[model samples]
Target: MPEGTPELSAKDLRTLIPEYEGLALATTLLNPEPGEPGVRESSLGGPLLWPADEPWPYCAQEDHWTFGSDLRNTTEIVAGTVPTVPILQLFARDVPGLEFPEGKDLLQVVWCALNHEHDPGPVMPLLYWRNEAEVVAGGLLSEIPVAGEGEYDEDHMPEPSTLSPTPTDDYPSRHDLPEDVRDTWEPRFRSPTSGGVMWPSDSNVIATKAGGWPAWIQPADWPDCDGGHRMEHLLTITGDIQLGDCGGVYFFHCRRCPGLPWDWRFDCH
Candidate 1:
């Protein structure tokens, strides 16, 4: 509904699976210049409004998918900017009609320092914050200080020369789409090439219908809910959120359970 090609119409999809429910699709392409407005309520390619009291998040796990000498480079890039790494926050509350667990609000945070690295190493760094207030106060209401110069760790600072070249092709179109794909969708739907919804129309299967980019629906990676049922596909933050070639950030949640804490995962292809 946010303006993109849908893989299947609700009527057509229901014909295939009568029990199919709908999904809300949102897509955003970020601008990477310094000093620009980086934070927005439900968009990607923006800065995160992190509390000044919180330390900048670092990949502490030694076995992280993208760990090694490149870690330093990634760290440096994140810290290179005057105001820490750009963070994108997706809140379930802001997503109209999203049926999240009761008494809890879900927020998925993603940050990647190296958007253009040939190999972004491992999965991009991610954080999940679950606010348990009935009214969902604080972070949403309070005016907090954002991370700025001298706030981040100095040791991880990057040298001016090592930063990845500024991304010139902010949003590249998919020229390699197969004839079948090209024929099935319109030009506007096929181009822009990245970020869109892959709604779940077949039981637990998520079908890619919007942008040519596909959403990865990995049940094994889905976080379990207290209701004893697997989480459902909420939506995906697709496009170049700096995770490397055509990476997508997927979000899942349990409709029956309340505040199971962690419910999101990231993957790229």
Candidate 2:
């Protein structure tokens, strides 16, 4: 638990609903606030400690556009690929519980900020795991390419913010609950004032989180890797950035597979 975060223990909830006893999962809530964070620090939408020698990533998807009535910034459409923007940078030191690949201590998330109507996910995000020491040893990329004005979907472009990683226990949303468990608890989750059934979906923190279950707005859609192993939730991006109609982007990885193959899904309210 981090300081000043109101104590909302899932363990206590479990005492009232024993069905949740075996469903609690350990997770870290990334409480992000607008600020300037160093490249090497754990941050949301902050500068990355990228190797200077390595080529920066760009979105070559042909559908990339910058002009549209629906877009936040409706400037003239730009031609060719748009540079992928930084969304997150995490240091193992800041989040010790995070499982980094062997010899890797840093995790960076960058993505194409433009919309992808044809694709399932709104933003085509990418993940990178790196060694902090090796990046510094090689030399850091001083100038990272960014999407020029009107080149990105403003709703998806997050402002740089520092992170306060707070450890906590998270239980699955009612949708992810076992059929029997949901059936037992659903009827009891009524609101006294409204006299309407008020499901505690937000009990699972709907923020940028690591591990635990996803704060799903709809039915849970867990993806599987080529190895046939069910993927584990790696990270959930929300709150700090406005996705499609207050949606969330989820990242998942399969630890059982070599190289930890990953996938993503997007859901909106």
- Top-TM-score structure, candidate number: 2
Question: Number of clashing pairs, model 1?
Answer: 7
Q: Model 1's lDDT to the true fold?
A: 0.38
TM-score of each: 0.43, 0.87
TM-score attained by model 2: 0.87
Least well predicted 10-residue stretch by lDDT in candidate 1:
162-171
Clashes in model 2: which pairs? none
lDDT of each: 0.38, 0.80
Steric clashes per prediction: 7, 0
Cα lDDT of model 2 by residue, 104-135, tens digit: 99988998887664662456688999999999
lDDT of 1 at 233: 52
